[model samples]
Every structure is written in C-alpha cells, then in structure tokens.
Target: MSLPEVRLQIAAVTLAEELSFTRAAERLNITQPGLSKQIAELESRIGFAVFVRDQKRVELTEAGHVFVRGCKDALALLEKAVRTGRATQEEIQPLVTIGHSPYVDPVLVSALLGVHLPLYANLRLRVESMFAQDLVHSVLSAEVDMAIIEEPADSPLLTLVPLVTEPLYVLLSTDHSAAHLASVSFEDFGKVGWMMFPKRANPTLYEKVMEAGKRAGAVPVEVHHYVTPHEVIQLISENFGVAIMFKGIAQQLERNDLVARPLTAAGLQVNIRLVLRADQSSRLVNEFGRAFLKRVIPQGQQAEISGQLLLKL
Candidate 1:
C-alpha cells in the first residue's frame, strides 16, 4: 500500500488531538471543508475510517488511536531528521525555536535574546510570539524547543522555571476616583466596567482573575473582553472601562491620560516562566536554557533569587 501524504498525516493527527473540526482546521490554517476532505482522502487511501464523526462531535475510531500514535512518532522522527540534516551542513548552526507569550515582559524576552553560551557559539535561536496556552501547546508538539510564558496549568510532561513575578496593576483614567491612590484595592472599582483579555488568550489566568475578584468580594458591574493593549488603553482613557493587567503591560502602554496602580488584591499576580518539555534531550537547547537562566539570575544570587521567585503556580 502507498503511504499517505505528509499533509494528510498531519491533518489526521491534528484532528485527533482537537476532535473539533473547527479548531483543528484553524490550527492547520485550512478551511473546515478542506480539512474534512483531507481526512476523507486519507481514509480512502488507507481503506479505513480514522475518525468517527457526526454533526455534534468527532471521535477517533479504535484503529485511529493506534494510527495517531504512529503518526506522532513518524512526525517527530521526520523533524529530527530535518534538524540533523541541517546541522550536518558545513556551516549551518543548530537551530532552536523559542516561543513566548505576547503578555510576558519584554525584559525576559530581551534577556533570553541576550544569552551567549560559551559552549555553543554557533547556536541559532528563533523566537515566536503566541498566546500563553498556544506556547504550551507548541512546546508539547515540538514546534517550539522552549517557551517563555505566563504560568499555565501543571503538566507532568512539562517543567516550568519561574522568571518574573509582579503584582497586577489596575489601569484607569487619571480622573478616576482610585487614580490618586498609590495602590488600589479591588473594592475601589467594584462597580465600574472591568476589561480583560478573553479567556481564550490564557484560560488559567483568566479564571484566576475572576476567582481573585470573587475572593476579594469585588465583582465588576460588567466585564468587557479586549484583544489588544491598545484597545484597553483606548477604553480606559475614554473613561469607558478599567483593566487589571501585568505591570509590564501597563508600563509599555503608559499614557499621560492614564494611571496605573498596583492591585492590592491577594493572589492577583502575573508569573512569567520558562517552560520546556520534561523529556528534553537536546544538549544545545538544554545548555542554552542554563546560560539564559544564569544571565537572569547571577551565580552568587541563585540562592537569594530562588526565595524571591514564584517557583510554583
């Protein structure tokens, strides 16, 4: 039997993971109908239905589970082969892909970019910016060697090394009642419109923000979802809303008409971290991580920095 096309294998694997045609297609950058056609062609070539699908949901058939496992292994091996071939070229440096959450502080990104490992002078680093959850997924899928992201849910397959921890800040108009305070309590803005990124951006952080507000006994009169810092800035400056976000984000978008005050609510902090697969075996990638961490936390202060860092979520 002829082997299925590589794209077909990828479509099947992604569909298996997501089980939602809409999402899998989005990940593949293909239309839903196009993805369905690929799966159909793959099944036709293989003489078996890999997925059991209906309008309501999609499920992998008995054989699909085994097939997907093999596909994942094959894809991983193909990736390794490509990397090995590239590294074997006379002048090519080994490439390591690093993903970062868009919300993470620029200093951390700058620090990672500034790392210079003595042992791997020819190492090449590529960085991609994505949402926090997408970074985790990319790491798991081997699309990214490592990622700097906001704290995500605990996963046995991943290790997280905390990089930065700072209290969330409330952004509001200078004329707002709480603008005069050095720090604002959640209660101060409990009755105003609250603006935040949609849950899809970072579900864990989104839920944490909601839970934090509840614990502080402060719920907004209405919550507005925003997709960009500029939008948040616009809304707050126009006195249409207020926001709770990381200090770094607030600082980056600071404006004369706006003011940011540390949010004094407990458990409302943004924790940036370095996340990598627990089973990582690349010496270049591993050493790069060590060198980067050393740059962020100097040798003599490792012990002291450990105490200050939020080591766990």
Candidate 2:
C-alpha cells in the first residue's frame, strides 16, 4: 500500500473525537458518507480497524488510538508551519503576536510600544484580545508568540513570569446609593445585581469573584454575562448591574457614571502574568515581554505608594 494520506489521517482523528459519523462530518465540513469512506480507506491501508462500529456509539479500536495520536501531532505541526509562513511573508517586519486578557489595562499598550519602538523600530505588534484560557492555548499552540494573562498557567508546557499584582475593586454607578462609601464590603453589594463575564470565557476569574461574594455572605443577585470587560462596564453604566474588576479597568471608563471603590477585603488581588511556551526562544517575544514588565511593575509600585499615602492622610 502507498503511504497513508494526510487528509485521511486527519479525518480519522476528527471522527475519533466526535464518535458519531454525522457529528464528525459536520466538524470536518464534509458529508457523513465522504468522511466514512475516508476513514474506511485509511483503515484498509493501515490493515487494522480504526473504529469499532455499534448501533448507538462508535468506539476507538487499539489501532485507532495510536493513529489518532499521530494524526493530531501532524496537524499541530501543520498549523505551526502555516503560522510561521504567514508571519514571514505577510509581516513587513519581525512580528510578535501577544494575546491579552480582558482586564489588561488598555493604556499599557501605548507604554509598551513606546519602550520597544526605540530599539526595534521595525517590529510589528499584533494584539489578540481573548480570555485567559484561550490566550494560554494560543501560546501553547504557537499561534501567538506570547501572552499577557490573568495569572500563571498551571500547565507544564508553559513558562510564566510574574509581571504585576493589582488590587480588585467594586465598580459602582456614581449615582448609586453606595457610591460615596470609601470602600464597600462584599456584603454591602449583596442585594445588588452584578455584571459578570460568562463562566466558560473566564472560569478562573469568575470563580474568584464568586468565592469573594460567598465569603461576604453575598450571593450574586443577578449576573449579566458578557465577553469583554468593556461590555461589563457598559452594563454597569447603564444601571443594568454593578461589576467587580481589577483597578486598572477603571481607566477605560469615560463617563462620570461609574466610581471604583477598593475591595479592602483580603484576597481580592489579581496578578498579571506574562506567559510563553516553555521551549520558545524568539527575540521578538523576549523584547515585548521585557517592555510589558517594565511598564506594569512601575505602575504597580506607584499604586501601592498612593494607597499607603491615602492611609496616612
């Protein structure tokens, strides 16, 4: 038999993931019969049944297990190759793709570009706004050179560098009754509805916010799930719901409709981290990472100092 076809191998792996021939066909954007024929041909060439057929569910056979694993590895490599090719031909200069979490302070981007422009004048920066989990996946898959995520990733394949830790705050409408308070405990907002991101988009941050509410005996009265931090602020401004976010998010607001109060309660801090693939050794990524660290660390220190001065007053 000739060498196994790449498309056939890919089809086999996709089928293994979906289990149902119809579902697998949808995922691969092919008809069910076409997908079935590809898988059958692959099995024939490899001389082993790839999937065990059943009336209700399709199960992977032993040969299927090994073939699927290999196919996935091949697909990953192909993805990396395509990304690299695009970077080389389309990018006029060295390109660094940086994935950012929703809470990443927008002002930091200017500071980052300012610092790096002097040294790497021709460097191109591409910013991808995504959730922390997706950012981690982008870095791991070589889709992005690096990322600025909410916290250190727990995965062994990524290396995380601590950048800055910012305090979390409760964002209230300026016209709200409790807005004048110096700081509002979670209990103070117990009866208030909250604007929150969806659990799937930001599981870690959502869980952290909920845990704080639980500790204060304050259940989230209502949650307006949104995809971005800006959307959450908009909902708060519209009086739809209040929100809990890091201090820097306050900078994104233009209207006097919102006021940010420190969440003086303990354990409400968020750490911004720089994450990259463990094996990556890109000069452009390293430069951007350094610029990001230099900008955030100083701002964090200044914020700390200002907070202390307020206490002294």
Candidate 3:
C-alpha cells in the first residue's frame, strides 16, 4: 500500500508536537485508534518506529526525530508547490473559506472584508460563523481554510497570528444601579447578574473573567449563558445581566439605553487572532492575514504601527 504524502507528514508533525497519541488525535479531531493506525501505516512504509510508547508516555525514537525533521521540510516544499500551482492557474480562482467565532465584531469583519475583497478579485472568499469550540475544531479538521478566534491555542502544529487586542468592558442597562459608575473593576462585577459564554465555547475567556472577578472581591454571582453577542446584548438591555465585551464590538451593537463601562483594571483585554494549521500555510492565507492586520492599524499609521510592533506571535 502506498502512503499518502500529506497524511504521513501531518501525522509526523502532530505526533511530534504532542508526544502522545491521544492528545495529538484530540487536537487533530480524530480518534486515537485511527491516529495510531495511520502512524502504524506510516511506520510500515518507512520501516521504522516513529515513537517509543509506554503505559504512561510516548517519546520519539532516534529515527523518529530524523523522520519528523525531514517531513517538516518536505511538507513545506509541498505546500510551496501547491501555492505556486494555484497562483499560476489563470482560469482557476481559489476560494478561501475563513471561519470566525460568533464573538468577532461583524462590523469590523465587514470592513476588513471590503479591504481584502478588492485586492483578491481573482480569488473567491467565504466567511463562516461558528461557536469558538466548533471554530477551533473546524480549523483542526480543515473544515474551513482558516479562522479568526479569541481562544489562545499553544499547539505547536498550528500557526496563530495575533491581529488585535482590545480592552474589555462591562455592558449594562443604563437603568442598572451600577451604570452610573465612571469605571468598573472586576470587584464590582459580582454586584450584577453576569452573562457568560458557555464554558466549552470559550473556556479560556470564561476562566479569565471568573478569576478576575474572584480577585476583585466578588462572590457567587447570578450567571447566564448565551451563544452570541446579540443574545448577550439583548439580555443586558432587558436587565437580565451584564457581560464582558471587547471594545471592538461596541460599534456593531448600537444602543443608547445600554452602556459600556471600561474595565480600568490593567491587563484586562480580549485578544483576537488568525489561526490555521501550520502545515497548510499558503500565499493567500498569509496575504489575507497581513491585510486584516494592516486594515486594523489604519493607512498612514502603518509606519507607526510597525514601529510599535502591534502584530505579534
């Protein structure tokens, strides 16, 4: 049986990063048994053990290290060939499917789309919206070409580019008793009903909010769960609860009766990023990523933004 080139490279890269079959399979959104079988097939084709496994842990063998390194370079070159082929096909216009979380500001996304669409007139583009949990999964499974996500993924096999970081704010009904406060601290959060994204949808952000609240002297709070910013805003307007929102969304959600109190606490921010599998990198993906970041920084301020080193990681 012939080994598929892409699958072998991916299996090697993912297993190398995780050093555990189960963990790598989870990241790749595949079953552990399935991943193990693929690795076994790859090993058979190469006539070597890629990983030495025990009851508790998995480690790379000497041959595994060499295979992983060679595959990385080989995969990169293969990606280059595909990108070059796509760019040269005059009759073929590649459609780039970009996935985004429900929390991403629609207005900002629309604006960025306007900037990107004109530049890539030859290439088609599609945007998909999903919950954070699903968005990350879609990226790993290649269900979408790329995604704009708030979750900070440290997976070594993925390429994550930080696009923007906006201050978090408290959204409340103007009539709410605490609405009059000039600025809100995490301590003040326990006073109001707290609206949160489902823990699975955005675990990192949820945990961060909870931890900040705990440090700020807040106790057991009335919490509500919602899927979209619209739902959270509607709940706030109805006085059901207040929510932590990134300042970027303020423009998309227009409301005079609802107010946003900036979180004055230092280090309180929402990070937005462009994420994709590192092995799937392409010229178009890089172009779109940089275009989105440039749009965020503004036209004449490109030099200023560059000097400040805004886009990181």
| Highest lDDT against the true fold, candidate | 1
Cα misplacement distance, residue 54 of candidate 2 (Å): 18
Which residue runs of candidate 1 sit more than 4 Å off their true CA positions?
Answer: 1-61, 82-91, 118-124, 298-313
Q: Indicate the residue-level lDDT of 54 in model 1.
A: 97
lDDT of 3 at 169: 74
**Per-model C-alpha lDDT, please?**
0.78, 0.69, 0.71
Q: Give the per-residue lDDT of model 2 (tens digit) for 1-313.
A: 6557767776787788889998776544345676888888888888888899877889998878887998888978876785677546434577777778767766665555555645566777777888776676577667787777775435545666666677777788888777889888877774768876577555656677888778878876677776666776667766676777767776455367788887766676777766777666555565566566656666545444333211110
Q: How does model 3 fare in lDDT? A: 0.71
TM-score result, candidate 3 = 0.67
**Candidate 1 lDDT by residue in tens digits, 217-275:** 88787888877766887777666679877787877776788888898877777787788
Point out the higher-scoring one by lDDT: 1 or 2.
1
Error of 2 at 214 (Å): 1.9
Scored by TM-score, the top model is: 1
Looking at model 2, residue 134 earns an lDDT score of 66
